[model samples]
Target: MNFIKVYTLTALFSAFTLIQATHANAITAPPLETQVKQVAQWFTGLFDNSQQVATNPSIPLITLSSCSVALTNTNPVTGTENIYLEQKSINRFRLYSFSQENSAVNLSIRAFDTNYSVTGLCNRPESEHTLDSSKVLATSCNLQLLWEPTDYIGNNSPNGCPTSSGGKVISSVTVSENGIDSLDKIFGANGNLLFATPIEFRRVDSIPEPSFTLGILAIGFWGTSKTILRKHKQKSTVSEESLFNCD
Candidate 1:
């Protein structure tokens, strides 16, 4: 009996330890690429800054031209797929290029200004639907951007990007399905805050095509009419049965 008890106790302890280890792993497991993909969807739409700029005078009056997230074939050498974040403005354009590396994401940002005809080149053919190197006059910065939860936070690489604006910039952006909030700061060479902007952008709703909207309305009306007819048929059947029973 004592040997039996000892064996059972050992089995229970082993099971308990296994369970604890599995629970710990589940809690501490690194985020998957799918999670990042879902988060990217939140940023994949056109956002307008007009209302935000109007409400907050401190923020810059720059407009947000577009924000998009898509899968691209960028690195032919490695043959690895990557998620691309393209953000464009009136005067500046930025691309956050990222790929899943093991359990984490490796991200980098490339910035361009109006001097480089980025917008035009992006529309041109044979550019792989990417930036055209021939038209690019100069690249402003190439820095590593870090990802956390729903945010991408990073600063300019060490003396990597010298902006014509005369300061190093640090960017912190919080993104969601509804809108985006950004706190962008530029510090002078002396480490003093030269400029700061807190901007909010709201997502623009895509208007459905008139034909699609009409089709949906027609389907709804048809379903409603069918339901009404069904009820009317049931009522008529019940009245007919009553008359027959009275006879």
Candidate 2:
């Protein structure tokens, strides 16, 4: 009877211990946010293809200035979209008014030769007619230039347009006075831009590890308690049986 009680207690204790351990581990688990950021920084540095994957701009003695991508598309055949950019005192460019004839087919495209230069655009030179198609549809599309918002606004004012600093033009792009849907279609169809380009950034928040650790600990405690209770029951049963047999 004692042996039976001991074995039962041992099994109960082990199960309790296992449960407790699992709970503790869960509570201690790391949050996904920190992990993601760490991974992003590491990978961004590794590829860093910003410089290597450049194309040449048209116009003599001109080079295309590298601009940060506000938006991009892996596929762009479904709708037109706008890419917005600001060049400090020069111009707030909007690559707007893109659209496609057909929304059903997937667009595939290659890089064209008529790359743009920052200064060349300021000069208002005619768009170069490249041997390459001006834009293509496909796996991804890049933004080289965009429409000028400040110019659009100033051109509309009852009051005169704002003067820019250092003789450079400064303009702002407003939420289109036209509804977003109409604007989207205009931008999309105007030249086959991406369908939806919202002017906001999506920030993912990080979670701390301590909370996870605590949760794990709680699970472990519950498991251990159950195990202890089971062992106690088995011991009581064995004791009762032994006394009955002795009598």
Candidate 3:
């Protein structure tokens, strides 16, 4: 009886230890703010858009070098903050607004013609007529980025965006540790596909190594705990069978 009591207590202690270890190893996602910031940082970098024109030869040939996304200031009136300014060239730029909606990150893109200058009769003075106050040339499709276990998949609204070229543009982007994949489809007013292509941009930089190391460590700990628990269970079962046979 005493031996049985000792064995039962030991088993209970082992189970408790296993539970504790497993709980500790469990990885919890970072706060929404942190996630948004991380994603924003990931998006801000130089990219090559040459592949876009390569995949679709019909599209007008544009300068593909020096494509980049940079952080910008928040809007004061409309509160429609400009999180990232995506510059394709001296003439073409896209202002992006990023926000956290529940567990997902949403992106709204607005096209701008940086080459154009603001004329008089505008609300802001000529001195303040910068890209921030520049008229929105076009509003692109809204994009929602769904977070996966390892990366993010993004899709644009099917409604599409009307352009000055008398067509609508639809876009989708996928972001991962490796890089970004972007797809853009332009349809004419008659609903004829004008230009469509997918472009892959290699990452110019990577996320901090400490976060990755922590994730790896957590996975290892969880796996080790599971193995330990399984072995403990097998040993407990064998010991119980031997004790029963003796009895």
Candidate 4:
């Protein structure tokens, strides 16, 4: 009976430790604020096709400057941020709003046209990086991005974003710590590919990769707990044998 009790207790303890080990190994995503900030940081940079254009000169000299502006008033994500991206190649501008739902992050994009052409807007002060809600157009196709290992990839549904010319647009964007990849396709009403621009860019200013945080979280606690639990089981077995054998 005593041995049974001890064995049962040991088993329960082992199970509890295993649970801890599992929790330690489990990848718990960061809080919404932290995650939003991280994505915003990845997007806010001067990205140009310096390397890509060198290899294929045909690729357009696309310089994308994105900056994050903290929302103060009536935005969907008022406290988070609104990302403003200016494409220097074609004098185009875009606005992005981000929100989090569970483990996924959503990106809401809109084509913004101010009264005048805006160039080098990202480099300006934070106060000047915004526009009134009137400048924001309504495009309901929000890209649901998933963190695929090291990159966030997402695209709109088929014929989701429509062009003013009554054509359809399929847009895809990838955000990575290294850089950004974006491709936009405008299909005519007849399903013919009218225009497509695939742009690959590397951050002009290099930044440290934040993957080490996940590596440490995934390996640090569970590994130590697993080792200690194994040693503990071995010691407990040896102690029990010696205790019973002693006359």
Poorest 10 consecutive residues of model 3 by lDDT? Answer: 215-224
Alpha-carbon lDDT, every model: 0.40, 0.22, 0.44, 0.54
Give the per-residue lDDT digits (tens) of candidate 4, residues 194-239.
Answer: 5454667777875523332111000000001223234434433211
TM-score of each model, paired residue for residue = 0.50, 0.20, 0.51, 0.65
Whose TM-score is greatest here? 4
Q: Of 2 and 4, which scores higher on lDDT?
A: 4
Q: What's model 1's overall lDDT?
A: 0.40
Q: Kindly report the root-mean-square deviation of model 4 from the true structure over all alpha carbons.
A: 21.7
| RMSD to the hidden true structure, all candidates | 23.3, 32.5, 21.9, 21.7
Looking at model 4, residue 129 earns an lDDT score of 60
lDDT of model 1 at position 156: 40
Error of 1 at 232 (Å): 72
Q: Please write out the lDDT profile of model 3 over residues 36-96, one tens digit for every residue.
A: 5555556543444345446654432222111112222534433122432322322233445
Query: Which residue pairs in candidate 1 collide?
Result: none
Between prediction 3 and prediction 4, which has the larger TM-score?
4
